[model samples]
Target: MTEYATGLVYPNGIAADEVNKVLFVADFTGLHILDLVTGKQSWLSDGGGTYLNGIDGLYYYKGTLIGIQDSGNQGDRVVRFYCLLFNVDR
Candidate 1:
């Protein structure tokens, strides 16, 4: 198994950037991007700076990554129903 960052306590989604040779993982706390060749991992956004908590799925389309976050909380259902978009090349 690959060793992820300490902060990646709950990884729920995964996607790949073939052209960039990187893997994107959606963790419950944030987004982690890993370099396939170097084995280096970095956070795209730590949950504190962004509203990307509870990411559940990932999809790559036309060079963009779509992240689905579902917290399963009844109170904040409106925010949980949205998907986040990130440019793969950035």
Candidate 2:
């Protein structure tokens, strides 16, 4: 198999949106969205905060990107990320 991505530290969970032709990946480097058609991958930010701590699980449901992250000293919890709020280009 050929490698399709880089900069991922311990990739854990994956969620795919076939209709949108995208894959949301969770890794120690944070979260990223991959365009299946163009082969473009972009890192997703948590709005300029340290809220994202090496996501361990991910889910793409409807229009939301939900993830389970290890908050470090804050413990682990599930978070819902609204793509529109971040102005992510599809």
Candidate 3:
């Protein structure tokens, strides 16, 4: 298979949104989004002031992004992100 992405520190999990043609990748660095059609990579920031880090599992459910995080100081928890809130529909 061909490498679709690079420059990730520690890739852990991924989820795809077929309807939006986008791919969500979670790594040790942060959360990232890849456009399937345009091949554009972008960083996803939490506007709610939640700093995402050390994400290990990713899931896309009903237009929402669910992230399983295993951080050192933050501990283990789940985070939900509304896909439509981000400017990824381009």
TM-score of every candidate relative to the true structure: 0.65, 0.79, 0.84
> Over the full model, what C-alpha lDDT does candidate 2 score relative to the true structure?
0.75
Off by over 4 Å in 1: 1-7, 46-49, 72-90
Q: Per-residue alpha-carbon lDDT of model 2 for 1-90, expressed as tens digits?
A: 845578877889888873767778888777877777677788877667657656788888877888887767288888888765433345
Off by over 4 Å in 3: 86-90
Q: Cα deviation of 9 in candidate 1 (Å)? A: 1.1
lDDT of each model, Cα atoms only? 0.63, 0.75, 0.81
lDDT of 1 by residue, 5-80 (tens): 4567688888887465677887766677786667778777544545766777886666667766665533232222
Per-residue lDDT of 17 in model 3 = 88
> Over 4 Å off in model 2, which ranges?
18-20, 71-73, 85-90
Considering every candidate listed, which one attains the maximal TM-score?
3
Best candidate per lDDT, number? 3
Q: Please give, for residues 1-90, the per-residue lDDT of candidate 3 as tens digits.
A: 745678887899899985767888998888988887778788887666886778899999988889898857278899888877544555
Displacement of residue 36 (Cα, Å) in model 2 is 0.6
Better lDDT candidate (1, 2): 2
Task: For residue 53, give model 1's deviation from the true position in Å.
Answer: 1.6
Cα-based lDDT at residue 42, candidate 3: 87
Clashes of each: 0, 0, 0
Candidate 2: residue 28 lDDT (0-100): 78
